[model samples]
Target: MWNHNYEDELIKCHRFAVGLAKEIDYKNQRLLEMEHKYNETMATVCRLKEEVKSKDTRFLEMKQKYNESSATVKRLMNETDLLHSEMRKTQSINRKPDEALKCKKKELDQQAKELEESKAHNDLERRSFLNDIEKLKEELQAQEEKTDAIENLNSVLLVKEHMINQELQEARKESIESLQNMLTGRSKLGIKRMGEVDWKPFGDICSQKFPGEDWAKISAELCSEWQEKLKNPHWHPFKKVMENDEPQEQIDEGDEDLKELKTKWGEDVYEAVTKALLEMNEVNASGSYAVPEIWNLMEDRRASMKEIIQYIIKQLRAHMRKRKRC
Candidate 1:
């Protein structure tokens, strides 16, 4: 035997080197991803902090303005009290046989007019201050809400990091297991791969099954490079709603025949009607409404589908635009 143990050692070393390389690559990729996310999150946090700082500055300015307004109001009130006391003293003097009564009366009238103008100005300033305070309060509330949303985002990020760590651990465990299999005189190793699921085809399937289901709606919302957002595992619609989704199962005890009709057709009939109502030209729409196939579906349920069709038509040009870009 030409060093059989040495050959075995060499084989084991090769396998270890391969596994180590793979593990390193995996770790490096994950590190890059985590760094990217960290940078982005840090940027967001920085932006929010700047916003908060600005808001605080504005709030302080507002507080100063409010204080100034309060002081102004207090000064005006004190002036009013002094004016009333002076007017009383003038009245008493007038009652004691004044020489320049007309002159005194004219002076008193002028003073009263000035006082009225001052009061009006004071009232206007008070109203302005109150309005400013209200606006400030609204802004503060909005800022607080934004802060709350940011905190929630941070929490989500933390959860994502935790999940990623768990995934790395699992990958390591699996790698160890694979290595163990290779060493234990196992003849075969089977590998499983995850395939990608295309959403558009699935949406199309859903659309056809329920034609009135607004396939165009999804296409309408699609924009440039929007799919890049899907890279974030936490961003999926189902993942988002998974935590809080409480399905409310309710039984509809309406007309049995109508319910039966709905159950038989599912969403397709409604879609067909939607297509007829929405996509057709005016002449076609009017002509199709008269057809038994179009109206009978709704008529059986004792519902006026025509009204809703008319309403939508009046609201917007009701037509399903073909998906071109997405």
Candidate 2:
């Protein structure tokens, strides 16, 4: 009876394992389907971008053709007007018979009617061309909006993919731990195996790479590597490092210089000097000012200061030149 019971429990465990394996297989197939769909979406976005580019090129070509056609029509109309003027002069000078004159008048009336029809047709074509241009503009705007939406969707997908990867890694870790526990649980039966793994000796590897380099040089190189790693403008670590690196003495000296300039030159000269100094820097123009109070005051008075200083400097420089020449 005991042997039968043991066999029954083993069978039950086997059935559970089989069920888990089938579930895993189904999950893998679903993952593959999702991956295929992601690939298709990416391909579609690429094709759409190419199509939009082609459409823009075609639109520009059409616009140029329309402009050229309009110019040709205008030239033809001018030539027709000149010919009409010449015909009128000839009619007056020739003094043909009254019936011939009436016939000529009838022919001129038909020609005028044809010309008016041609002008109306040309006007219709111009309106149609303008409508086509407006349609293209609307399409371009819609395409741009779609591209932006796709970009946003891609960003969201990237975040989801990262989350999925992290979860998968955690699952793999849990599986490994479970396997290790099962092996250890078999130690009482003398069925356990043991081995050791050690971390690579990073210090030894470094020593081997730089066999004769001193510790000081290695330390300095490491510090430089760390410095490069920390140099992100948006990161707090680099900003803090930069602020600390500025010597107190140098900062005090700079403050003293600014104070003295302000005290001697007053607010106007101080503002002008600050503007000149800031304007001298290309980066300052491109980037936001670090010192807002100083920069704002200078920027507010910049145009006026520019004109006044320029005039004053020109006079002073000319006076100095004359004195030197004399």
Candidate 3:
């Protein structure tokens, strides 16, 4: 009996060892995945660092240019002041020569001639100086504007990069949260501890809706369908504006429509979509006037249908091109 008890204990120990070994193997797999993710993150960080370095170099170059431009403007300003003083001296000399009671008026005519020539030369110099000043001021303003633009770009780039990283993190967090919720909800339902209002069924239904296929292909197909839907005339604005055809009223109305859409769709997607639409409309309008009715149709169709509106203009362009060829 003692030997049998000892054998049973040995069997239990062997089973425990196998289970522990399996757990260790599972942990090792997870470790490998974590290491792979870490390496990928490091590579991404390196790329970002290089991008930031390039941007910084560009910023420094712009700064240097701006300084040089500012210096040139200051020099021009000084030259302008010197020219003004010379003009004042010439004016005073003109007065003295005209009023001079000495040496009689014998050489007055010659002096007057020389004075006039000097005046012409001085006037030319003054005009040239003023032009130079204006040019330098314009250059300085342009440089300042460029610098500001570059700074804004730098700030925007940094913000966009940070937002991208934040979005990636949020996506991962949301995915994990969703997975956890799904697991918990499933477990609750399985154990009969879920309420009538529990959403497990809905979650499961949604999960079933996604086919186990390439999501990229699925997205492409969906976008193509949307594009087709947009191209359909059912959504087209009758008498839509073209780039060369937009009247002031129509432009204002379009701007209003854009504002409304932005209010409705939030900013991002609306901004992207509206800007594209505006470009298309501007191209179609091309500084030409369209009827108010046409403008109204555009406003009406834009909300309910965008692709159809674009398609109509596309057709018009094609028709015009054909006519021109004929």
Candidate 4:
């Protein structure tokens, strides 16, 4: 019984050992396949690990670039803000000069308008001045013509006076001869003639008293003295007398020649000459009656009052004759 039990135990033990060996063989085979697969998986894992490592290096580079770009953008933004501030200041500074330029332009336009108006006024004044000059020229021409007419009238009168003087001288000589003949006949008949006196003896006595002086010589001296007196500024022959009244005294009352003529030539001759002088002064006092200036062609000096009166009378007669003929 003991042996049988021992055999059974040994058989069981052998079976158990065999089963355990087979199981161990299967496990070993499976373990070899796993090991092959593991070897392939390990190669794949190494390749994947290498790719992950490259990706990590690229990400780090991108992060560094992003930081640098952010810094640059901040700097650019600050420069833009400064530029805007300077532009605003420039616009504020330019405002006043632009307004002043506009005001200066307005003033220049006003000055130009005033200059145009002044030019127009000057043109009008020039035309007016030209018209006045034309009128003055016409007046001067008329005055010249009147002066020429007056000169022509004076020349015609001079010739007629000379002829009349010669005829009067001839008539006076004939009358003086007739009176002397009658006086001689009365004295021969021994008849007393009223107011008859011998003038020849009286003339001889007067000549002897004067001693070498004659009437002609004394008359020339008196004329020269009178001419010098006329040159005085205060010497005026015509007195301002009332109408229809004679002057109280002659202007030449103090003249020595006049006193001598009165004493030598007697009162009648002095009175005749004085009356002629007074008439000439009255007629030639003023206005148209005043004598025109006449030059004596024969004597080469100023014309006497006697010559001027004769010239005026002849001019009047010639004008009257011309009117009658017309």
On TM-score, the candidate that comes out on top is 1
Tens digits of lDDT, candidate 3, 173-200: 4433333333333221111111012233
RMSD of each: 36.4, 35.5, 36.8, 52.6
lDDT (Cα, tens digit) per residue for candidate 4, span 98-180: 55444644554455455445545545554565587789999998998998888887776766777777765555344333333
Between prediction 3 and prediction 4, the one with superior TM-score is 4
Estimate the TM-score of every prediction: 0.27, 0.26, 0.23, 0.25
Off by over 4 Å in 3: 1-103, 177-326
lDDT of each residue in 222-309, candidate 2, tens digit only: 4343233223233221111234667221122244544674674355434443433333232232222321111112234322323433
Question: Of 1 and 4, which scores higher on TM-score?
Answer: 1
Q: Arrange candidates by TM-score, highest first: which order?
A: 1, 2, 4, 3
Report the C-alpha lDDT of model 1 over 55-110, residue by residue, as the tens digit: 74664565566566566656666666675676678788766644465565566566
What are the runs in model 2 whose C-alpha is more than 4 Å off?
1-102, 129-133, 140-144, 167-326
**Best by lDDT, which number?**
4
Candidate 1 lands at a TM-score of 0.27
lDDT at 260, model 3: 68
Cα displacement (angstroms), candidate 4, residue 97, comes to 16
